[model samples]
Target chain A: MAEETSPRGPERRRGDALLRAIHEAALAELAEVGLGQLSMEGIARRAATAKTVLYRRWSTPHELLVDALHQAHPVEVPTPSADDLRTDLVAALKLLTDWMGTPAAGAVLAVMTERHRYPELAEALYSRVFDPRGGTFTSTVLRHYANAGTLDPRRLTPIVTQIGEALVFKLTLDLNRLPTDEELVAIVDEALLPALGFPLG
Target chain B: MAEETSPRGPERRRGDALLRAIHEAALAELAEVGLGQLSMEGIARRAATAKTVLYRRWSTPHELLVDALHQAHPVEVPTPSADDLRTDLVAALKLLTDWMGTPAAGAVLAVMTERHRYPELAEALYSRVFDPRGGTFTSTVLRHYANAGTLDPRRLTPIVTQIGEALVFKLTLDLNRLPTDEELVAIVDEALLPALGFPLG
Candidate 1:
């Protein structure tokens, strides 16, 4: 355990610190060069480490990228405060907006946007990062409410679960900007909650 | 009027016929070369026409491409069959699916997917094509129902009008396939109708 420590200083990161730096470097490299041009040597160079160090942890840049995205994937925490489905759903989408502003999000977008050219990498992304991280933002929150008996389990169909994220994407595509807080609230009130069989006034 | 006739047995096109040929060639050319590489020379070559003929009507490839998308854009016909909201909504989304199968859809996708790279083209698409064509597949149908005093106009907010198209785009992005008829029906029954104030059994 003592050997794991960097005796010199913070200049030489070790253990979890080293791993985090490598992950961040992978994402940054992906953003700069895109998925088609991602290379282990490039990532190692960006991380200021040796290619041997990266190969010790991951076989290929694809493996390292998936791990980077998985580490950066957000997990929703459904609040138990008064069983507020609206607040929870909004907060979950807020997490998505926050994540969208990250370097990992750009990496993920590059992979998805050019998925046809990199099918294997795209497949790894879904299997390793998205699926293992509860599929989507509102999905975890919806499942939590369903478990709490606050929402009808049957109402949480695939179409219903996809509403929030879908509209967010559509709105973004149309407006060329992230949805404001009020727009997010309108999404919950107008589309998502209604599909969940909530009474609309 | 005599001069307008094609004397060489359809070899020399003119007027609306020639205009349509140019439009189709533009869409095909956009799909082949993408937005950045689209040009009058390529479109005219594909259409077997002179560049001067194209210049007479349109200023640039962007202008011609937008016009092609507009011309090829589907207009919804809301059938007045027994005031059936479910059937009409499904039919509307079906129009979207059909449009998706066309070359124009690929052209549109190329522009949208690379909107940041060519912001003016994207802007022209919305203002000239999408907005002028009722905005979305279900938007026209929603307005029809609202006008017929069948659906509450209050229910046809921007979010509500967007639900059908939003889900369609989202499903296509996730599944990488067009939504089948059964899936479209599910969208109507599970999401659209419920939001439009129809009771779910």
Candidate 2:
């Protein structure tokens, strides 16, 4: 699989292939043995690569696992052209629910729970994964609503963010179930809309 | 401290003393070292007892820590004789805020998060610590309000429970700040009351 003859040259191709192999191997290991059981030695063995190669790129298992998670759930910036706040929020929430409801994401959360025992790992995960994805989208949608004069501009961010965070918490920690369509609707109608100063009859 | 010392026997006092020592030591260790570092051996050492003594009553660290939590935040059954549902709920929320705001209670929550990794421990915490205590008061307040024609009766429990859970999550996980008195009032008035069909101005 080495692209030695490619126009981009052998070095770039070799690096790309190595990263891909390591990432896939890490994911497969995560699925089979869980995060607590994941190790660089195990991942290198699974990928048919030496442990030195794995350590050269990533210093710790936490860093490697985080990179794998990023690959699995690539960040998508939400454009606020959906006409209304509720529609935009529903779309954003759907995106969040879909990503979090997956088995891989569940494993990620399990790892995160364990990661909390290590504060540095917890901080890394929060900054790299949690905040940028969900937090950004929620804030952007609320800002758009506030700009449009529909929402109370002052409390918009905190309110919408709280609702979104609550939903995520419910899925990950409380109910351990996916958010149903009905729940999505209730959240938007009963919780988010009111907080945004919209009247929902 | 054994309470087994009856008027005719000395056995009762010995049992009571042992239990007291164990309980006090557990609390002290939790406060000083936190949940992550809590261990049965540590508790035994602090209590001036042997590890075998702790193991005789509790099989695992999780069980001992959970029991300690239960003893700390025991279920409080509310007597809702107040005419206004708002007043009763406000009183209950105040109590909840005070309990959750304390450092000791926060330490108990630190242990609860660890319980998430162990499902059985999570279930036990939910049933013993969560549901019986605050859950009962919340349900009673909602039922009383609905019956008195102050709010809608259908699905009141779930709605109120969600709001309460959200508040707790906000304090413990997200914002990491206790809900202010004003914020608590706003939550009850804006979210809980309106969702239960109470008209909010």
Candidate 3:
């Protein structure tokens, strides 16, 4: 009865709100400044919270940033209707492209660089970042076609599925920009579809 | 005769020797401590030279690293005799994989993160790192097969040629290791060959 009636309930709500704010601020900081420049005090400043509040939750900025990436993202790629493999693949990869244009891209890129030094973070990234984020989703889409004999089974491995992501990274690395609509179409029609044994419509 | 006998001859040789030493030391430093942590001062320390010496040559550490990647490397992929596309593609990609397995990979990876910030560097990378190194060779190989009507002309574009590179990065990012020869063979025989039209032997 005391738990239900307690004023502490409001405090709990406030704490949740503060954590949400912190997550947003932390990711924003990571994107703008990168990991080497990230600091707990900076995150706190951005979140409009006290440094003590941050330390109470995370021992270091790295801990906080990693936690933020693990949190559930609002992005939920609409399930492809399995109508056309080309349309389905383009839409799925395009969803991923939008995500890459935001702060999430920079944050993920910074953490990936640290992968060699932190194996634990790498595993966490596999489960929390890559799989849920896009890898598994895209693989399932490609695999569905492979299983149905619409796409060649050999062309449907996880690595093969990332042909779009590779083009995305190539744009990111080569031009330092996300794929243009023209580029996306080219990747889908000119490259990925044909590579997987499906040509243009 | 005066030009050849001038004391400036030894001075020129000495300068060349120091530049070679500096390039080696810079790449080693980049491999050991990535770009985020790299400093011209640290590179000078490792090279056993003055920071002033480095500054005289390069305006910044970024300049030095870029210059190092531009210097000629001993890698020369044997032209695949134009006999078998499979054999040629595998040999060309294999040469690239060998290059990635070296300290050069780390150096290049570090420089790439800076690409988003430096458009000029991006073009330099395209010409010096991507094109002269392997892109042109691989494209020519793929184009040969395409012209023969064996592989689709669509798969012969610069973007399509990156299929092998994408797989390489997938292996590197996901596994933190380069693909084994067997893996490369599978990639060529199982994936690339089929994607481009021709399948297993």
lDDT of 2 by residue, B1-201 (tens): 664336464332258677876776787786666555678988989987889888989998778867777776754555577787777876777776777655446555555544544568678777877776444555667766677777656546343357655755554455446677777676666665655555456
lDDT of each: 0.83, 0.66, 0.71
DockQ in order: 0.32, 0.15, 0.28
Candidate 2 contains a number of clashing pairs equal to: 15
Candidate scoring better on DockQ of 1 and 2 = 1
- What is candidate 1's local distance difference test score? 0.83
RMSD per prediction, one decimal?
7.3, 6.9, 7.6
List the lowest-lDDT window of 10 residues for candidate 1 chain A.
Answer: A73-82
Worst 10 residues of 2 chain B by lDDT: B4-13
- Per candidate, the number of residue pairs that clash is 0, 15, 0
Give Cα distance to truth, residue B111, candidate 1, Å: 1.9
Minimum summed lDDT over a 10-residue window in model 3 chain A is located at A4-13
Candidate 3's TM-score on the B chain: 0.80
What is candidate 3's lDDT per residue for B1-201, written digit by digit as tens? 365445553333357777877888888987776666678999999887889989988998878877777773555654657678878877777777778877766777766775554557556766666675544346667877777887768656556676677666767776678778777776676556656656344
Better of 1 and 3 by lDDT: 1
TM-score of each prediction: 0.73, 0.71, 0.79
Q: Candidate 1 or 2, higher lDDT? A: 1
Better of 2 and 3 by TM-score: 3
Sequence-dependent TM-score of model 2: 0.71
TM (B chain), model 2: 0.73
For model 2, what is the alpha-carbon lDDT of residue A72?
68
